[model samples]
Target chain A: MSAPAALQVTRADVCCVAAAEAWRGDGEIFASPMGVIPTIGARLARATFEPDLLLSDGEATFVTGTWAVGTPPVGAAEAGIAYRTVFDIAWAGKRHVMMGPVQIDRYGNANISAIGDFFRPTRQLLGVRGAPGNTVNHPTSYWLPRHTRRSFVAAVDVVCGVGYDRAAAAGPSARRFLELRRVVTNLAVLDFATPDHRMRLASVHPGVTVEEVVENTGFELVVEGEVPETPVPVEEKLRLIRVLDPHGARFREVPA
Target chain B: MQVADKRMTAEQVVAELRSGMTIGIGGWGSRRKPMALVRAILRSDLRDLTVVSYGGPDVGLLCAAGKLKRLVYGFVSLDSIPLEPHFQAARQAGTLEVSEWDEGMLQWGLYAAGLRLPFLPTRAGLGSDVMRVNPDLRTVASPYPDGEEVLAVPALHLDAALVHLNRADAAGNAQFLGPDLYFDDLYCMAAERAYVSCERIVSTEELASAGLPTQRVPRWMVHGVVKAPNGAHFTSCAPDYERDEGFQREYVAAAKDPDLWAAFVADYLGGDEEYYQKAVARRPVEVAE
Candidate 1:
């Protein structure tokens, strides 16, 4: 793609661009991203390429414009989203969530539940908030600030979100609406477009080597010849991201 | 004739709790939890209780008091503060069993119980570790052969539900001046009894005038009401008050040491709601980071 004149981009900026790319072509959908990085990405997507993406004020109402980080919307919202209405949107599959889990496997089975056994977890993390319904009902992508052997485990200790294998075993009804899309990490952008539904290394971020990604991942990854570097965000998108997140909290998640 | 006043002290309402009974506490995280009722439970000798909640300081206080034998919850977080330290210590020590569910599934269970259904079929726990941790949780096959299997979240019937609202009448009608009701009404209906603690006791007419939109819980659903000022302290009650961040930091920091935690709990846990409030007022507020 041709550059939009005058753009300076960092690796972390590239990662946000990749995260925003996950929701590309998604016209008019609830783009709910959990953590700081994904929140910036969702806002970035709404402000630029995916103007149709809907955002909430992180409280009770929806906002047409991207909100500055650490601040609620100052103007009127597009509409109100109550506790009951949020569930209605999710059950209808009108939502696309970018979740962050503690562990993820080759098949995209993620875990945010606990580290040890189910009965007695040594290190307990957040329980499955909405991962199960989000995965089965609509398209779900993952964003990990740090990617390592521990996070990209051979197998998750607990399966908080159903993977392709588990979804298939659960039957065709389970697989129909299931779309396990991009897995955006600090190191690389991976997806399950392979024949076996394994996570394929889509692109290595700038200055990151394919060898380093392979060394850090616990399970085998699908790496085809000549892995491409993730595309850099144009000047317009970069400027928009800075506005959406004036506090630079996104940098804390994936520092350049 | 004046409506029978259901007003009682927190100690009196908490006395209704028996050993080995299941209870549900309302609020999400550290927001609007019935800390006064929780403190009352701590003061009592209640033991082996099964507590179901979204969880906040209430769970931590109960856990620290050794009152819970089991905790059925989606998560146990303190909002601005991450995990509740006392809950973590209790879990690590294997003192109590836990049935972890998705946040939606827990809500569905309560909804089903409130509606008097055997179970609610939901997609929330279908592929999560919630089922694995809660092995007794079952799934039912869809009637249609092509239909996907859905997890059946059983009804979470409770002996009592303890909640704190911004205002209430002597007759038990409650109003939440906050932005969100946090499913306090569903919890109230899902229980055999619901005891509410409010920041102030207004007349029935005044509660009605607060407007229908703000009336979260109706009179019929509430069995008892306690006038506990600063009832949901240290937790945000919205329009009424914001979270006591400095005190929360102190609570979290104190839990690290047994002697310190014991001393902290002793200072904050006993006495009625007013006594607790005055005690809090006396402490020096730390500067926010």
Candidate 2:
């Protein structure tokens, strides 16, 4: 038998696949290109970054950091309209949010804020800042970047925003919404089983082991009998990003 | 019984308009605003109107369709949908005078105005340029002369409050069933007269049985309540009903192409109010699955 060629893959390569697929190559900034979400903000320009909705499944709380609120980070500056319009260019609504806490429940519910009570209690986190509305409103999705059981639990401590179950329950008006569009990670592609609430196995990222995904999940998800591997970013997505942020604001790991 | 076709007619409602009036609109970032009524106001030749919106297509259409002079908003929002080009062009051309505040601040401002309070103190305008734009809204000099942040957004008083609801009783009691407990209440309370459009008009008894009557608008404050079906189409979906997905997709796609957008407006808005229905009649429903 011919010896298997030496494996060629790294975390960086895997990360890009995780993100690019979530965006489905539609994050067109200028309607230009790259179309990558803000998470992989480094893969884009560094001007003004307004992440869609923080998508962490690991942590349900917020950390006090310069990037959380205050001034814009380094990379987000470029997305602003060239000249003047209304507010500054920092978060002109282009976004790829981060969510902490690794395990996400079947309903796409997350727990990042606190483990117990919110006020003067056990764990305190980024107090529900725009989570409820953000998830319901814009192009919202979640990300573990790194997945784990601690992140995905039976249910979140609190359902800060509408997830798949709630979105469907809300009405047809909100049907095309929070419906957990995508959940990206270091391993695979996850989608819902039906128009209902079951989180189903969509596909695996190239080189990720089925065991890795199983180990990371908190609740029981509908596993696929045969899962295909996710594809990497095509030349079109890369070329598109280059045009949207010619200044290279999003691609680099800079502060914005 | 619920009022069947209980309306003063389009001309009748339009005739009630006066100069230098304030209007309350029901919508959020364009999802549920009354674009048709707004266009009607534009065609009426009304001017110097102070328009209030929680943020919706109403703001842009009013400004772009060439009707508004001044605007009060918390944020004229947009989602996957882009900012209305008419509003963008107007803002660029400096024809529309726009004012903004935080969503909560805007609601409370209207609330205070409704409650007849001069203003309400809030923490929303902090750390944002809204304080600078509407400096008159911010405050200074606490009791101890130490620095304490406070702002008093002006109380909004409107000549008319126009809202679209899911259900209403002919007696003018309207009910809102969305999570957006926005300034609709405050707007209606602050206005001198109120007009409501609803997807369905149910009998007072049915409304009472539904247990939503408590939230209904009393006849005393309501000037007119019209049973306008599909009223929120292309703008916002009726809760629990179908969404205007095709229109939304078409709007975003058209907005991507200005030439296409211009042609779209010419074909649709150029026609009568029913123009939208006929244009969308042949359009296939997206997100149908």
Candidate 3:
């Protein structure tokens, strides 16, 4: 008989784990993920350790349970979320969001608006959805399915989400709840814990080297010591992840 | 007992639209957009329209028709499909003047207009490139000496607002059965005139029997109600029907080429609402492999 292979953990799995780690201390905060991997990560966090993580039904309700991706909400919603309630939660500084930006800079300034000059752009992206409010009101993280030099840029074309530098410029009020925490990418987990608030290499995903991350990133990342491989998802978490994303769209985003 | 007859034909609604007017089109992304009226405006040869919308294909179609002089929007997206390609081409080519706001700011602007307020104080664009890019935007100091300044999001006063809903009474009381009201009512109250196109029109008694939330635009706020079934069409009017993904895909794909786009506009938007419905009914929904 052939030996059973080790748990076939994929890059997406590591990325999800990294993303879930970003929400570790967030207590009873609204968890909003703007993309597929981030959604999986948010769902994974909710189902497992972060039981208090409030998840949206993708329709305007707060739903509990391991709801699968690519499926209409099957379970009963816990509560309704109107536009006013969303603002209430945001203004209370009780939310954490994982957003995907078209371009991100060293200081964590990201852009989801125009690509070229602000007046006349080469490409147009989804205009800033809620980046400003999310960044100014509460904690925020980033998810990058594909980590490349082009995406991790030296400077963003336009700042949609306020970064450390921009927030500081806005004065102390804008910096109150503003925390650019972790950035979970396909290759590695990054954080802005540096003194200068530059992107730092937190942990490289398994099978990826620090040099590879440096080579791919457009700007320098703070590399202090020997980087560790991001922790593999446990069997329970893996099982839950499978149940949460039955269609396997997460794998498609950050393939095995 | 006398009740107002607010019913209107799509063409009648279009007749009210003028060149250089600021209009608001309701619905989030492609959901429940008043596409029938948009088609009417497209056919009317109206130009120099400054549209305010939580945009979708309405923005794309208007841009494709060269009807838009300026766009005041949060974002123009087709949800499942990110950017509306026609809007993309127009903005990129510098053919359209755009004033983009954060989604919340756009909604706030509508709310302020609805309340008849001069401007609303918001933290939405306080410290970002939103200010740097839009130099016309100004800040308002807090009334309290201790309070910090905020961006004074101007009132989005529309000459007319077009919105679509699942159901409405003949007197113009509209109800949205969908999860989100999506600033539609605010758009209605914000405009000088409000036109609602609905999937069906029922009696006020039927509206009450349906037990829709009290969150509805009263008859006093609405000017015209048009019964344009399948009005939202490609845009999803929840509980009525899901978005026609196949048609939406085709529209998005067609927007890339001038020839294909022309053919698409001709095929679907060639005639009035009845012809468009017939075309829609005849075309089979493509089953995903």
Candidate 4:
């Protein structure tokens, strides 16, 4: 018989690992991840390092065990929190939601709402759903499967999620629990860790260059020195990812 | 003493609603919406309405029909289809006024209305463009030593509220057998008048025994109960049915072109609710080749 093949890591796997790292230190908080890869990442995080992280089945239940992406939660209903309770938990600053925005700026300002004027937008998207409250109340992060100049803009059309500069300007109340943790993209991972609170190039994914990231981004990113490659998932983590996404829905999101 | 029955037809409920009324609609996104009542309103001569909703096809239908003057909402999305096409078209054309609040802020506004409070202080919209977009919103400083300032989100007082549920009794005690209540009770409590349409009208004893007691929308808040089977069509009512994704796809497709939209309206929305239901039943099921 032929020997077992070596575990091959894909771009989607790297993105999942990077996305999971957003909730590395967040403990016992509700992890509301939107989209496929983010959901997979949140599940992986809960399955391994962050065991205390509460995960919802995207409808209205808190799921316990790990299940594959797109499958129904088998036994999560009995101990589920209703929609009203979800609002309460979010308001109490006990949740970290990773969202997918249409446009995001260097300052961490995101817009899932309309594009163009407030009154009459050229393209109307989902009106600021919970982005405003989520950013101002608790920790928030973002995941972009496709990192292009269009998404990583100089300025967002509408500020649904508050950035560091705007939070600072709003004073003590807005800054009370506001934390924009991380932004993971297909090309690289970014964070607002700079002194000026601008978006910094945290790390580039394997085979992706810092210059390539810069070229893709519309604004000037805070690239200090040599950017390290995003760490590949360990064997166990890769297995967990596979287990969490058996049908490979993550591949559909980030492609091969 | 006998208990009064608050049962009413969809048309009767729509007849009570006046033009330019601020109405709050229950259900989140595309799930469990009161589409039957919405269609009734569509059939009526109602115009210049200010609607408050989590928004799904109800908002899109109203926008397409030119019934809304203003819309106060957190978001309007079809869950699967991210941006609602008709809402997009209306906004792009500058046809309606909008007060876009944070989802939590909208909840707070409704809660404040239910409590009969002028406004409630919340940290949401403190630093975002929500303040800029909604210039009427004000910030209040804390009375204590910290002197912290927060946004005092004004109450979204509704003249009327419309919601859908899984079951209800004649006296208007509603129950949602679905996973989430989705703030439908809050929508009822926040309004001056509220109407609930359900998939089935069960007895009070059956309603009480069928679901958890906590899931019931008490009769005291609801003014009218309507028996509307498959009421939340296109949107999901769960247990009863899931979102009609095929129909919704047709809806989204129709919204793209004027000719297709006209054809859709002729085919689907030409007559009463019964006609619409019949048309929906007669649709050819898509079979993958």
Can you give the TM-score per candidate against the true fold?
A: 0.95, 0.53, 0.96, 0.97
Top-TM-score structure, candidate number: 4
**Which 10 successive residues of model 1 chain A have the least lDDT summed?**
A3-12
Model 2, position A240, has a per-residue lDDT of 43
Q: What is the lDDT, from 0 to 100, of the residue A174 in candidate 4?
A: 93
TM-score of chain B of 1: 0.96
| Candidate closer to the true structure by DockQ (higher is better), 3 or 4 | 4
The residue-by-residue lDDT of candidate 3 on A12-88, one tens digit each, is 87787888888887879899888888888888887788989998977689987778888877766999887657766
Predicted structure with the largest lDDT when compared to the true one? 4
lDDT (Cα, tens digit) per residue for candidate 1, span A127-179: 66667777888889999889999999999998888799878776665576788
DockQ of each: 0.56, 0.03, 0.68, 0.86
lDDT of 4: 0.92
State candidate 4's TM-score: 0.97
Residue-by-residue lDDT tens digits, candidate 3, B163-236: 99989989899988888788888999999999999989998888888685843877888999999999998999
Candidate 1 per-residue lDDT over residues B98-159, each given as its tens digit = 98887788889999999999899877766566766788998888888666678888999999
Off by over 4 Å in 4: A75-78, B211-215
Instruction: Write one digit per residue (lDDT tens) for candidate 2, span B70-114.
Output: 777654545445345455555555576766455555666777888
Clashes of each: 0, 64, 0, 0
Q: Which residue pairs come into collision in candidate 3?
A: none
lDDT of 2: 0.55
* Model 1: residue A171 alpha-carbon error in angstroms: 2.9
